[model samples]
Target chain A: MARVNNWQLGREMSYWYPEERPNKQFAAVFDINKCIACQTCTLACKTTWTSGKGQEYMLWNNVETKPYGFYPLSWDLKLLEMLDGQEWSEDGGRYEGRTIFESAPAGERVLGWRPEDEDYSYPNVGEDDCAGQVDGGASIQMPHMAWFYYLARICNHCTYPACLSACPRGSIYKRPEDGIVLVDQGRCRGYQECVRGCPYKKVFYNAMTGTSEKCIGCFPKIEQGLQPQCFVNCIGKIRLAGWISKPGEERPDNPIDYLVRIKKIALPLFPQFGLEPNVYYIPPIHVPTSFTRQMFGPGVDAAIEAYKAAGAEGDDDLTGLLGLFGSTEEVLARWKRSGDTITGYNDKGEEAVSVPLREPVSIRPSYDKLYQITRVNCP
Target chain B: MKKTIPKIVLLAFAILVAYASCGGRTVSLSEVVVVPDQQITLDPTDGAWYAHPYHPAKLILQDMVEPRLLEPSTVEVEVTAMTDGKQIAFRLEWVDDSQNDLPGPQAFIDGCAIQLPTEESVSIPAPQMGEEHKAVDIAFWRADWQAIVDGRADEITSIYPNATVDHYPFDAESLKKDPDAKRRMEQRYAPARRLGNNRSGPRKVPVEDLRAEGPGTLSPAKTVSTGKGVRTEKGWSVVISRPVPGFLSKEKSSNIAFAIWQGANRETGARKMRTGWIPLVIRGAENE
Candidate 1:
C-alpha cells in the first residue's frame, strides 16, 4: 500500500496503488433544496444508457427521499455500521478514524460488502414511508407534510476509486484525461469484486452478458462537450456539471469550484470513506444538522447556512450561479455573473447559456376590453 | 531447501509405484500412478471408472499468501485420470452439501481446475500458480457453464425462476421492423461478449483452456477444452478433457496440481483450496 493524499479527509491514507491523479476531474453539485423527487433524471438515464436486458434494475441516476430512502436497501447504514462510529478531527477537516481502506479485513483490498439481489430490487426502498416527523403519528395537519428532501445520486467518479483498486485483474480504470472511472468490458471477468468495492454501489452485475457494468458518467456525451443525460434532463434544475480542480488550484470562474471550494456551500457525500468523491451536494437546511453532519461530514453546518443565506438574498453570486444549472446542454466549463445575467461557457470558452437571476412576473387586468369579457380571478 | 527433501522422497516412491503398476501386478499406488487403457471414458457412472483408482489428493488452505483466501472449505478432492490415445481427461469429485449452479454477484459456482507446467524441467516453478518465465496450462470447469452448455438458458429468468421483465430493447417487437436498431441494441447490451471476453457468458463449452505465468496473469489460451459435470447425491462429479500435454516427455515422470472451489462456501477466484505439486507418473504411447 502507498500513502495518497485525500483532500476530503485532509490526510494521507493507504491505497493499493500509488498516487496518480487525472488531469481534469469530472464533478457535479446538486442542490437538494430544489429537488422535488420528479425522477426525470432517472428515466432519462434509463432510456439513454441502461435500457438493456440484464440492466432492467439499473438506475444510474435516482432521487431517493432521504432520512429513510436508499437505492440498494440500506447501503449507507450498513457501511456506517461497519465503520463503527466514525470520528473526525474536532474541526471535522481531518479524519481521525479508519477509512474503508484502512479498516479492510486481512487479505482483502477494501472493506466493503456486496448487496444481495434483493437489495437492488428496490431502487426507492423507503420512498412511500413518512420520513421526517412520523414518529409520534401526528394528525393530518399541514405542518410539514414534506419532511424529507430528495437526494439525486449518480456515480461520483472518485479520485481514489475503491472499485479500481479492488479489481484483481485491474480491469477497472480511471481516465487520465477527464478522471471518469470505467470498467473495461474486454478485461472484466464478472468477479463482482468491483461491485463489492464501490461504496456508492454504482457497479452492477449483468446476468445475461456475465460481466459487470457501471455508470460511465455519460462519457459519450462528455466527449462531445455535452453534459450527462441525467444532468441535462433534471426537471428540478438542481444539477450542474463541470470540471473541478485539485485543492489549491481552485478557479473562481469555474462554477463547480465556486460552489464547492470558494463559497464552501457544497460538500461531498461521506467524505470519511476516503474516495474523494467528485459529486458535491448543498445540504438541506430543513433537515437536522445532526443528521446532515453525519451524512455530508463536518461541512454540513457551513454548507446549510450558506445555502440558506443564498435564498435569503444574502449571497447574490451564489444564487445567480445556481440559475445556470439546467440552462444549457453543454458542460459549464466557466461561469460568470454580470449585472442581472448569469452566463455559462462551454469547454471551448464559448458562451453556451445566459439566464436572468429573476424571471419577470406578468399580470393581466380583470377586464379585457378587446375580448369584451371580464376575467374571473385576475385583477 | 529442506522442503525439497519430502518432494524428492515422494518422487522416488512415485517412480517405484509406476514400475510396479507397469509389471501388470495389482498394486495400490499411493495416489501416484494411473495405468492407462484404450477404452477410457468420461462418464463417472461408466464401468471404466472402476478400472481406475480414485486417488485422494489432500487440499491445503490458500491462506497467508498475498491475495489469498482467509479459510478453506473443501478438505480433499478425489482424482483419477484417463486417455483416449489422442487426448487426456481427468475426473475430479468432491463432497459439497449443496449444489450451487447459479451465478450472481453474491453467488459462486462449484468448480475445479488442474494445472500442469508447460515445460518439464529439473526446477519446478512455485506451486501457487507458476512464476515469471515459467508458465502453466490450466483446465478450468464451472458447474454453471456446464449447465449452460447442456441447454440451460443463460438468462435471469433461469436463475430467479420468478423474475419478470417488461421488455428489453433488443427483444422489443417494434425493433424487429428496424434490424439495424435491433442489432445495435443487442451489441450494446452485451459489450463483454462483443469484445470477446471468454470468461463472460454465452459460451458453447463448460471447460476453458487458460494459461498463466504468475498469479493474476491468467488469460484465455488458444486450445479449446471440453468437460461435463453431473450432480451427485453427495456433491458433484466432473470430467475435464484436454489435449495431450506437450510437456509429456520420454522421462515418464512429471508434476501435477489441483484446486477446487465450493460455491456454497462463497469460494471463487483466489479463494480456493489447492494442492502443492503432486508426483504424476505417466506412461503414454508417445512417452514410451
Candidate 2:
C-alpha cells in the first residue's frame, strides 16, 4: 500500500503516489435533494463523450436512484457486501475496515473482481425502483420503510485514485494541473485493472480498442473556463463545479471550496474508501439518517444542518453559491451576491456569468377550456 | 516366423493410422523441435520448417470465471519450431473459417501469442498471461497488423459501405500543413482506424514484444520482434520470430505457452483458447 501521513485514515494504507497536490483540483458538489433522476445530465454527457461503439452502456454521468438503483447493478452493494462491515472511530477520526487495497488477497494486483459484460450491458436495469414491501390490499402502507433518492455520479477524480494506482502500465494518471484522472490510450493494454480497482466502477473497458476509458473532467472545456457539459446541461440545477483547494488552503470566495470546506454542507461520497474523492455531495436529507451517515460519513448531521441554515437564514453567499449551478457555460472561480444578482468571476476577476438570484417572472396567459393556446391578458 | 512378421506389420500400420487420424497431436513429452544453424526467412512456406517435426499441441477453450468463454478450438494448431542460433521462430497453422483481419468499432482482431518466461528460474509463468512474482515475455502477432503489412488496410467503407460521412473538418486545407496531419485527422474522426494505427508497428515488422507480470499487466517491451501471417483458402499460417542470444543447453529448457484470439467470436482478454506449458527445446549440434 502507498505510504501515507496526515490523512483522515490514520493508518498507513496501500501504496499510492506521493501527493504533490495540483494547483487546483477538479471538484463538484451535487445536491441529491435537488436531483430528479431526469437523466438530462446523463444524456448530455453521453452525447458529448461516451456515445461511441463499445461505449454503448457507459454513462460518464448517471443519476442512479439510491437504495434501489445502481448503474452497474449493485456496484456499491457488492463492495459493501464484500467488505462485510465497517466502523468509524470518532477518537481516531478514521474508518476501521479493509480498503480496496487492503482487501486484495495475495497473488492479485487488485481485489480480484471482474464484472460480467452483461453487468455493464444494463446501466439502468432497475431505474427509479425502490426496495420496499408490496401489498395487494387497497389500503397500502409501503411508505413507512421504503425510500429512494437520486444519486448523481461522475468520476470522483480522487486524490489517491485507485484506478491510477492499480494500472500496472501506469497508463492512468491524475493531471498535475487540474487533477482530472485519465487513461492514456497509447499506454493502456486493456488489462482492466482500472475497471476493477475503481471502487466506484467508473472506469470502463473499451473492448474495441482493448483499453480502458473514463471521464476526463472535460479538461479541454475547463481550460477554456467552461463548465463541464454535465454541469452546464443539468436540468435540475443541482451540480456545482469549481476548483477545490487542498486541505488548509483557504479560499472562502471559491464557491466549491466554501460549500465543501468552510460551511461543510457537502461531504465526499464513501469516505471509507479512503481515496479522498474530490466530488462532494449534500447527502439526501429525506433518507434514513443512519443510511446517509453510513454512505456519506459522520459529517452527515452537520452537512444537513448547514444546508438547512443556509436556506432558512437566506445567507446571500450560500444562496448565491447555490444559484451558480447551471447558470453559465463558463467556469467560475469565485462568486458573490450583488443585490438580486449572483455574479460569478473567473480567476482573473473578470465577470464570467451573472444570474438573478430569483428569475424575473410575469403572469402567464389564461388557458382556454380546450387546453389549447389562448392569449388572455397580454404579451 | 513369416506368420508373426505379417501380424507385426499389420499392427504397425494400425498404429500409424490412429496417429494420423488425430492429426499429429503430440503427447506431452520432452519434445525437441530442431533448428538448423542457417539463416532462414520468416516465410511459413519457405521449406525451412520441413526439416523440423510438426508437433500439434492440443488447445482447449479458456473457460475462466472472468470471461467464461465456452467455445472450443475448431482445429488444432500444427506447430513447427526452429532457430538459426541467433533467432528462434515458430510456425503455427490453424484452420480458420474466415479471414478476420480487421477489427472495427465493435470487432476483435484474430491474433496469437507465444509466451516464455524472462528468467528460466522463475518457473513457467501462468498460462493466463503470467502472474504476480512470475513474469513472462510475450510475442504477440495480430492478424490486423498482418493485413496492413500485406498492403491491405481495412477501412470503414469495406465493412459498411452505406456508412458515409458528408464532410470532415480535416478536409479544410489549413490543417493539412502539419506533417502528421493525416494521422491526427484519422485519430479524431475514425477511432477504429486510430486503434489499428496505434497498435501496429512499422510496415515490414508487425509483431511486437510485450511483457506481463500478471493478468491486466500486459505492456509493450522496449525491444520489438518480427512476425508474419498468410491467409490460405481454409486457414491462416503464422510465423513469429524473435532473436535470442543462443540456444539453451539440453539440460535447460524454456517453457512455452500459446494463446489464440478469434475475432469472429469476440474472443479477447481471458476469453481465448490456450495450451499449457510445453517444455520448448532447441536441438544442440551434438543431438543433430
TM-score for all models, in order of appearance: 0.91, 0.70
Q: Which of the CAPRI classes, incorrect, acceptable, medium or high, describes model 1?
A: medium
List, for all models, the DockQ compared with the true complex.
Answer: 0.58, 0.11
- On residues A147-172, what C-alpha lDDT tens digit does candidate 2 reach at each position? 68889999999888888877755778
Q: C-alpha displacement of A357 in model 1, angstroms?
A: 2.6
Model 1 chain A weakest lDDT span, ten residues long:
A138-147
Q: How many backbone clashes can be found in candidate 2? A: 6
lDDT of 1 by residue, A1-379 (tens): 9999998888999998999989999999998888888899999989888877678777878888887899888888889989855888898879898889898888888989989988887787778466565546666543244467788899899999999988887889999989999999988877788888888888988876778899899999999999999988887888999999988899999999999999989999999888999999998877767777888999888887787788696577888898998889999999888888889999999999999877677777788899999988743
For candidate 2, give the DockQ.
0.11
Candidate 2 docks at the CAPRI level of incorrect
Residues B124-240, model 2: lDDT tens digits: 677777888788888988887786677753443444445464434555677777748855754553343365534523355668788888765777686557978888676888899
